[model samples]
Target: MKTSLIKLTLPLAAAGLLAACAGGPQPPDWQLEAKGSMDRSVAAYMEGNSRVEMAELERARTQLTRSGRADLLATAELLHCATRVASLVVDEPCTGFEKLRPDATEAQRAYADYLQGKVQPQGIPLLPESQRAAAAGNAGALQGIADPLSKLVAAGVMLQTGKASPEVITQAIDTSSAQGWRRPLLAWLGVQLRRAEQGGDTQAADRLRRRIELTQGISAAARPLTPVTKP
Candidate 1:
């Protein structure tokens, strides 16, 4: 039930693609088979699609939301996958961030494996390489790895899915900082965290406070850039 905060602010997939999911209603399958197909389709659609019909995408979104699958990912991940589909379409060679997603489910694992197998011609589910994952592995673990996304996804899927404990979110922000990926995303997460706290999650608020502290540290290390280029 992990959802990435990336889903709420960004399209997850590039704008054109997810909207394309807006087609006529899809055929039904046994719940298991259908869930699998939907997941694959979402991944595939993300691999190579530019435009998505909003209506179709919304329908697909509904389908996923209502599905009875376990370890079901957050809507944000679907959107993220949709963007990947668009990317694969644009640059099939781009296996950019696939490796960072180790927790992605089996078929998703297969797809990553397939991409690597093309080179080795081997069959085990090999993970796509991502410097980000390496970095995460090296850094101190972050507690709330999927706080924003997971909680949101759960809230949508189940009635009692509560906001992440602030402590958890704070740890994730700290981890993200220690590993990089900070930038504006961290700043944004900060605001959202604050709002979330005011909405009755003081823990989320505290994390946001720590995030602000981390961002300040990062800002200090950065040097102002001049237009001049080194020869």
Candidate 2:
């Protein structure tokens, strides 16, 4: 099973790409927290029932919309990711994902038109993540499927529990991003490490070392995704 999982990830993960949103003002800190929270809730939603209840999605949508700070651009990106990841969960068919996805906001409508087989006049890359992972099922592939902010959820959760150092954590993110990965990979790295530890795979653990080691002969600096704020 470990080998099976790795095989699935090898081609996809090998590239180590990260997703980036077009430049814009970031949502407020509170919105950031809400968006981050929604992500963890989403994982639980996916891991258990394969889909979240409409109520749950509504709550997330509500939180995201609060403060008059709705980020439709980010929301559409989130839905795009959710739609794609729906294909990955073996337990869940991608049935209602299209409908179940939080309604796309007006700003996101343009994006939807493009996704629904329509072409926008502009040549912007609306499908970076999918384009990056076309032939593989690596996390980088999922980078397109999952919201970049969603990655912060795991890291935030870890940080909240005091399991990691913010400084070292920041370093970990910097190290990976300098290599052409997105900032979110820092958080996903947290999830991946936890997965390896739980599965008790030394080989996988060693793989982390080989993957993270740099020209300096030091292992990739990974700190637990410890959150500084309260839950």
How many pairs collide in each candidate, listed in order?
Answer: 21, 7
Query: What lDDT tens digits, residue by residue, belong to model 1 across residues 81-170?
Result: 333321122133323235334555544444333322222223222322221121123232222224333222221111111223444334
Cα lDDT tens digits, model 2, 1-231, are 000111111122212211111234554564444444444444433323224424455555566455443333245234424322321211233333244335433324333332332324441243333322322212233233233322322223223233334342444344334433322332334444555667798787566544444321232343222211121
Cα displacement (Å) at residue 147, model 1:
15
- TM-score against truth, every candidate: 0.24, 0.31
Weakest lDDT window of 10 consecutive positions for candidate 2: 1-10
Give the lowest summed-lDDT range of ten residues in model 1. 152-161
List ranges where model 1 is wrong by over 4 Å. 1-106, 109-163, 183-231
State the number of backbone clashes in model 2. Answer: 7
Name the candidate that leads on lDDT. Answer: 2
Candidate 2 deviant stretches above 4 angstroms: 1-29, 50-55, 73-77, 88-124, 129-231
